[model samples]
Target: MDLLFKVYPNLNVEEVATETYLQERSILSARNDDVATLNELAINQFPGELHEYLAADKAIEDDQPIKNRGNIGCPIMLLRNLQPRDGLCNGTRLMVIQFATRVIEAKILNGSHVGNYVFIPRITLQPSVSETPFQMARRQFPVRLAFAMTINKSQGQSVKYVGIDLRNHVFSHGQLYVALSRCTSSNRISVLLGNEDDDKTTNVVYPEVLL
Candidate 1:
């Protein structure tokens, strides 16, 4: 996508390994699926062989086909709070440095522990009963590709260049503002509003909230 190239112009170059390059850019979208799509696209452009990690999902009669794919030098976000005191909190971002069968080696890219290498082991995860129709357990690394993340997930992250995929209108109040503000400079933000002729995006603002 043109948006991907504009926001991460060095993804296909040697600068991809630089800390500044890895941390200063990101793509945000309203939908999780759209975010995943953009993440895959960006990683595909990254210079490395594809490595796939399959999830072991178990449920009464249902199975979740969850798979994660990435390679060394790709950015990933922590899905669970493994160690908050050490800065391994949920939503912390890191770049993959090495991968083994049972664990992964990554360098922290955010927060107080930025630049520290840490080992992440695969962990068992269960969805809350109310969140799923059937009780399920999934065993997999608690990380996801971070080239792109949902607008809600991008809440605390600030980046230099941001590409917002607005093909799907933001569904929550302040979602548009969150995505737009993630970028340090207004001129460094690019947005795709679905159609070539569309120029406006819906922003949900309640007058009472402003008051």
Candidate 2:
């Protein structure tokens, strides 16, 4: 929590909507659940009327409903390649501008389409699961809150202020390096470790793979 505040202070300030302001900062974490929790906390602190959108989910075999959600004024990442030519590809970051029953209005934060406003409509997405017997499809605006994102998702994005949640030690090769390098300056990067007594965290390395 303290890490989040250190990275993104003054959420209510008018600069929150500026493209440069949103583009220059982000929080990185190793786990999806941790990222979601941090994103939720940051959204709740943002100055905006809360708007919620429920996804229409269905099991491909049984038409069963699965619940997913989104909100307005929240920073989000495109989950699918909506349009590559326009730069609305997967991992593109954007800020929600408006919400309707079936579409979301957002401004592109980075990439060639930066500052461009676009409308995102609901789309059907099916996950490939070899272990599960039944396949499920979710029809929703293809985005997820991104105030805090997984270290994997943070790849290819450069930010000025980066906060890394390292309470759960990194378990993949180069995960720590990726998180640390996202920031342009070492001094601008802040990491949260398990305890004050230790400033160390695991960085998984395969010795044979290196040699």
Candidate 3:
């Protein structure tokens, strides 16, 4: 993922001036790295969480659960089902697995979805293609997306405000640049652990990449 981010530096919004922060609050309030907070939010709202314990009759009430779209809260589980579709010579089903830490794993589940799954190979570092334990599960059901994290699809996209995990190892020069520069001004950006010293090696880099 680091290599991919480096190669496509322009894909992520690096200029804060372009973002729109609809919610005006401390950026930490967003808690981009708090896995516990995200789990709480998901369990509180998702259909399967604690519903059975709350008023059995009310819980059984026939009502469509609200669908989550747009910027999903962190620590989300994305499940994608891979099915073949006629379009590509190599029938590959599309499956994208993205981690909260911004690592992504994409694979071709079946030949039909090959076209849809091509984006991953084109943009990111390719993971080894093979049948594994995950394939066994995929064979039984349609697997779309899964997993949870503090940051969701919002990481590289333009946003009004952003919360970043500044743990030294996670804060690479490119990451710091991307996270801090997402907001328009310094005031618009907030770091949870701002006191830590920046790693000198990661902090200093070739200036040309910044361009």
Candidate 4:
């Protein structure tokens, strides 16, 4: 199970280029260039409203400083739910809180189950289990949700403000574009950084064409 943290700046401007290019080109490109490289470049230079929106989104995810909104509006919090997809532990119930914050802490009632409030730590606070219950439980306690998300889940949603967690290395360029484009305007986004290492990257650019 992976935990998402909130640590990014706001989504200030719309990256119009990437969005327009993606619209013109399908996500599946014929070229073999790493998608991250293309996203890093194309998103910044592409020319279009959507591209600009996506670029701004990428910028924010990269930890560029932006204005901060005290609170987010209509913010949809997401968690990576872990259930066994295969054998032995297959179908076992487990969940990982990807993003952890005081707000989430309060909302989840300190790992208390929302449906029954049974205080079942394994169900509410534990991560996926593949070993001894104690080991899993130990691992679960440290599995704090502290990573930001890419735009994968932000699409088709409207909100006045957005908080993104861009600390995870697994986040791809496509996810960043999707996350940033969700914002309608510059002032509507804010990004949080969970660690200093997350602050090292620069603007993302995508390849102009698959080669």
Which candidate leads in TM-score?
A: 1
Candidate 1 vs candidate 4: which has greater lDDT? 1
Cα-based lDDT at residue 123, candidate 1:
97
Question: What is the per-residue lDDT of model 1 for residues 136-204, given as tens digits with 9 covering 90 to 100?
Answer: 899999999998999998998899989999998898789999999999999999998878536987887
All predictions: root-mean-square deviation over Cα? 2.0, 2.1, 14.9, 17.7
Instruction: Show the colliding residue pairs in model 1.
Output: none
Q: Supply the TM-score for candidate 1.
A: 0.92
lDDT of 3 by residue, 1-211 (tens): 2221221222233231111112111122223345444334423432221211111111223422222221221122223322223322221222333322223344333223322323221111112574543311111111112112323323433434344444433433344555555555665554544345553323435578769
Q: What lDDT would each prediction earn against the true structure?
A: 0.88, 0.83, 0.30, 0.28
Candidate 2: residue pairs that collide: none
The candidates, ranked best first by lDDT, are 1, 2, 3, 4
lDDT of 4 at 90: 14
Question: How many pairs of residues in model 4 come into backbone collision?
Answer: 48
Span of 10 residues, lowest total lDDT, candidate 3:
49-58
TM-score, every prediction: 0.92, 0.90, 0.33, 0.28
Candidate 3 ranges beyond 4 A from true positions: 1-128, 131-134, 139-156, 171-173, 194-211
TM-score of 2: 0.90
Q: What is the lDDT of residue 103 in candidate 1?
A: 92
For model 2, give the 10-residue run with minimal summed lDDT: 61-70
Q: In model 1, where is the ten-residue run with the lowest total lDDT?
A: 126-135
